[model samples]
Structures are given as C-alpha cells and as structure tokens.
Target: MGLTVVAGMLVVVGIDVTAVQLARTQLWDAADSAALDAADRVDEDRVYAEGLHERVPVARAGVAEIAGRHLAEERRPHLVRSWSLGSRTGSPDGESAVVEVVGRVDLPIVGGVAEAFGGGVTVTVVSRARSQVR
Candidate 1:
C-alpha cells in the first residue's frame, strides 16, 4: 500500500511537470510567430525586389508597432493570466528583430499547487527572426 501511494504521488508530479512543459511550448510558439511577423514587417521587401542591399535594418519604432499587432493576436486564445513584452530590438547584424515575451501559464492542476505557494510559473521566451533584403 505504501509503495502504491508513492507511485501514485510520483505520477501526479510527472503529469504536472508535463503540463508545465506543454504550456511553455505553446507560449514559445506564440512568441516565435509574433517575432517572425514583426521581422517580416521590418524587412525591406521593396528594396530586395529592386535588387538592393542584402541587410535591412529595422527601426526601433517600427519594431514596436509591428510586434504590437502580432502580440495582440497572439493573446486571444492562450489562457495566460497576464503577458508583457519585455523588448523588441534589432540584432547586432542590423537585420533582425528580437522579441522577448513573458507569459503566465494557467494550467489548473499546476495553478492550484502554485496558488498554495503564492504563484504559478511564468514562462519567458525570446524569439528572433532575420530580415534580409536579398
């Protein structure tokens, strides 16, 4: 009976851990899509079509604007308690956008346990996508 109880407890832990992983993965996917969308906006497609330079630099304001639209869309379905965009900055190579996003995962089982501890896990992710004029 003792062994069975221990095994059952371990199984709950495993399931909770897996739920956390899945929630984190979903947040990551949202970040990836948002970053890519932002990067695409910052890209110099017109210049590329005109056979111009290879690297397209994204402006600071543009990054925020483009990333804002994508992030808004990303928030619709995910049951994050709350979310924030830490930063949207250009890469060192002057041809990419990096989006840093932080979201709270709200899985009931995990949330219940975390509530006992005063908090749930926050999943933070950074996603980058290159913007090439060529």
Candidate 2:
C-alpha cells in the first residue's frame, strides 16, 4: 500500500512538471510568431522620421496588437496578464525591438488541485526581433 501511494504521488508530480514545461514552450512560440509579425510590419518612414527613441511606442503597439491577436486565437481561456514591448537603441549595428507577453495557463493538473493552491500556473514568454530599416 505504501509503495503504491508513493508511486501515485510521483506520477502526479511528473504530470504537473510536464504540463508546466509544455505551457511555457507554447507561450514562447506564440511570442516569437507575434514578434516576427510585428517586425515585418514596422513602418520604416515612421522609424526614420521619429528616430528609434520616439518610434518605440509605435513599434510596441504593433507588437502588442500582433501578440494579442495570436493569444486570443490560441489561448482564449488563459487570460493575458501583461504585454510589454521594448526597443534596443544604439545597438552598434542597428535598432532592435523585443516583445514580452505574460499570461496564466490553467494547468490541468494544477486546476485539479486548485483547492490547495487556489489558482493556476503562470507562464511568461519574451521574443525579440531586429528592426529592418529599409
């Protein structure tokens, strides 16, 4: 009986760990896709006229729009907590931007045990793309 109980607990732990890792990986892929999409649509005229400093907000908005679209399509049930965008100026070579999207993933295993913890697992993903001034 004791050995069986231990084995069962171990299995539960393994499942939880796997779920967390999978959730994190999915978030990262979504972020990457969103960042690339936004980077591809960057307005060169705006960046050039306003300069990298002032263009950060514009680029950030682009990224957030793309990221939110993706998240809504893929993870609608998981509420997005925050979405942030950052611009890397004076990179010696050129300008670059980064988009970070964070949200809570309702892990099956965790949700099953929500009475103990009270909530689900939180996952965060950050993706960066270099601005192509063309």
Summarize candidate 2's per-residue lDDT along 1-134 as a digit string, tens digits: 99999999899879877877776776677777766665655555666777655223234445556655655666433433333332321122224445576656565655667636856766666777664433
Q: Ten residues in a row with the worst lDDT in model 2? A: 85-94
Candidate 1: give the clashing pairs: none
Candidate-wise lDDT, in order? 0.68, 0.57
TM-score of each: 0.78, 0.66
Clashes of 1: 0
Q: What is candidate 1's TM-score against the reference?
A: 0.78
Score candidate 1 by lDDT. Answer: 0.68
Could you tell me which residue pairs clash in candidate 2? none
Question: Which is the leading candidate under lDDT?
Answer: 1
